[model samples]
Target: MVFKLTSVLALVAALAVTGNAQRQIQGITFAWNPDTPNGSHNLPKNALAMAPISDLNSKAFTCRTNGLNFPNIKSYSSTGGEMFIVAWDMNALNSTDGPKLNGPCNHWMASTAAGTDNLKWFRIGEVGYSAEEGWCTDKIRREGQLVVSMPNDLLPGEYIFRNEVIDLTYAGKTYTDDPTMGAQFYADCLKYTYSGGKNPKEVTTGLVSLPGAYLATDKGLLLNLTADGKPPGGKYTVPGPALHKQPNPGSA
Candidate 1:
């Protein structure tokens, strides 16, 4: 009886862990197809139980779990200046699981390379904190969506668009102090193809590579979150490269 009870308790603990780990990108509502969007057809593949990829050097930091799962490989066509609604997959009971409210949410894009390794990525949109809406994560939780705008002057080609949320709740400590006690990164990506634009030029500047774009010691990632759900000093800089400015920025 003692052994059976111990096994049951272990199982319960494992179940709780699994429930907590279900935060990931589920589907993206693209401009072309709102009904059958990016990950809607691929249910489990898009909604994987991926934990935060803390190590900046890890390849999973690029796309988290679906980095290499390019089975469908179909690109949704788009122009630019469109709003893409991204949904997070979480356990029903724990819908508001992670990507803490004090952090920033960012969007990135990379031209399709041979593989998902070492591709150059550039930030397209980001929101950290504002007196109007508070933290971006809070807005994300309230709306139950992460909205990203496609660049207005992006060159015509296939690209991998990604959405990422950096949880800075415990970023006050360095990874050197404790491996799992620093910032947490959660991201997922899908493919898109751009066609016509106002004056589209290939993104040449402000491109950064994953695993190298962010560092554990960066000023933006080392701040401590206060009880008010903001970093100390009441200032926060969104990490990653600046959004490349095009000629004519359009409406979302």
Candidate 2:
């Protein structure tokens, strides 16, 4: 009886650990160099709070940078060799929302000045429902990190890198009006100063706003992943302005 009780206890402990592991995602923070002058990256005070649909245009629950200089500001090589590492936390009961079986779609963008104003931003790149992240799978999986490279000819100036992840599993709840079905939006901005570009043009053209950038009925945001047929059976269109064209540093 004693041996049987011990085995049962061990099995229970193993299951508990597995449950906890599934809740957490990896790379929710920027990977800064330890040798750099800037310290570790810090999330805004209200980073964990959820922003309502109405406040999408405004800097609703973004990092509260009141009177604070840019934290985790870093420099990047203009020759197009460097890559930015973006991460997120996805434990359901934790701060940010968890990934749905079909999604956790990602949209990354950038702007010159700092502020939550959507009008000042443009698309850099985006990743829609991905099979690598276990989209549409039966088990709970974490979509944690991404690596992004800037255009070689990117202008030299102060810029803000904005990363947005939309949880579409619970989307469509509100439908056409405010289709956020229980959808959750997670976003973070990192600051940077660039130099050494060959033909750096200002990124004022093709600007897009956050709330204005997406609609409730956008194909990528409102689709039902669990339907009997194959999930997202067509070319996935990332909602927003066209990708800005950058000159090649090598061409200069």
Question: Which candidate wins on lDDT?
Answer: 1
Candidate 1: misplaced stretches above 4 Å? 1-21, 31-49, 70-75, 89-101, 113-116, 246-252
Query: Candidates' TM-scores?
Result: 0.78, 0.62
Tens digits of per-residue lDDT for model 2 on 1-252?
A: 012333322322222221233322222222223234332233443323344232333445232222223344563423332444443333442323444334444434454455534336776766654444344222223323454556556666666666655555566453435544644455555666666456666677667655567665566666655653224663345555777764543454
lDDT of each: 0.66, 0.45
Each candidate's number of clashing pairs is 0, 7
Pairs clashing in candidate 2? 27-87, 27-88, 28-87, 28-88, 101-136, 118-209, 173-181
Q: Give the TM-score of candidate 2.
A: 0.62
Cα RMSD (Å) between model 1 and the true structure?
11.1
Give, for candidate 2, the lowest lDDT window spanning 10 residues.
Answer: 23-32
Name the TM-score of candidate 1: 0.78
